[model samples]
Target: MKNPKPTRQRERHNVYRRVREKIIGLDFSPGSAISENELAAALGVSRTPVREAMLLLTEEGLVEVFAKIGTFVSRVDPEQVAEAQFLREAVELASLRSLSTPLDEEKVDRLRDNLRRQKETGEDIRSFFALDEEFHRGLMDLAGHESSWSTVSAAKSHLDRARMLGIRKIPELGRLTEEHHAIFDAAVSGDAATAERHLRSHLRLVFADVKAVEEDSPELFVRDRDAGPHRRSAFVWD
Candidate 1:
């Protein structure tokens, strides 16, 4: 039998993860052209994996590749955001309902730790973003349906940039932690109804966030889906 190497697959996935995070984190702004060769050079890999990764992202609606021009990060779609909101609210709220009386002490303590870390993140939006995700995933874990979080996470990618945009634009970072506390308290106190209400409200805040972010960076999302930004060279940031 011939020896098989798995590192190539891992390399491709690493490239994908890095690129996807950059996209979701808004490091690569919407509509910014992404060059495969440039990405390969930056990641210390060859273009093959970079190209493959971009293809995978294309299937996920995160990247757009035109026939001749180039590949670029897709802009935030309002429809996608709305749909993602609906799905996320459904999953998180249902998870809340699934919580039995007397939430697990360990998970509750972990959530407390998450909230404390969230408070300490201060103005570091990236750290706060990661913690925000962890808090919600913790909720799912408490409900004993931790496996479902992967589905929610995958479906919520389109919604992330707008959420990230909202976080980055708003100077007061503690507001999110406050909201997390509300959800956590309601869940742990055996008030599933209130927890559901709080979680729904928190998830739907993205709509207002979308509006605000659109006002500040109109180019990040087209007001109308039919209209599109003119393709520019990868070097253009504006």
Candidate 2:
């Protein structure tokens, strides 16, 4: 028997993308409640699709639904952010190591172009993050590990919010561009080990910067110091 395609599924996906962008851009800030009715109205869609999209986002850990309180953007957990960074570094370094001598020129150019766009974007954090993802994905593609790139991309969402906050305060635009240039040079020179090392260091450095922001901006963070030792553990990274 041929199964019928679900028409609303496409609409749900569109809604999800729109809402997810808002969440990542911090338009829907952490712990901010959003009503399904209001969202549907704003998106010019029915409630069914909005609900479906919200459910999908909730599964992705991007949104939280409280029974009585309503749905809200999930707060960034520092521990989750650290774990995501660890996963990204592990996959990225492994992919880099697998690359032999004589790196691909096309991939190198792609990364260079991404960095150029990143620099030209200036303080536009959303555009910068998109280019940053593309830059890393280009390296992963060069290593012939598209699936690995997908895995790392999925894990990076938690780190995205933290990164957005960190970059806003720290002005990492120039530093990030320099780091990418360094990694690009190492990769194109066929220095796999050096490239992997630089990539790992870059991930760790960003994590440290994010942690600093969490400490400095307590109000922006959802975790409260008065919440006890659990909160401390959440923020502490190995």
Return the top candidate by TM-score: 1
Q: Write the per-residue lDDT of candidate 1 for residues 1-238, one digit (tens) a residue.
A: 2558555678899989988988897878888888877778888899998999999899888988876678889888878877888888888888898889777899899999999999888688888889989999999999998879888887778888888888777867777788899999988888889988988888777567766776787778846666544566554222
Cα lDDT tens digits, model 2, 24-63, are 8787767667788878887788999999999989987887
Local distance difference test, per candidate?
Answer: 0.83, 0.79
lDDT score of model 1?
0.83
Query: Model 2 scores what on Cα lDDT?
Result: 0.79
The alpha-carbon deviation from the true structure for residue 175 of candidate 1, after best TM-score superposition, in angstroms, is: 2.0
| Cα RMSD, each candidate | 4.2, 6.8
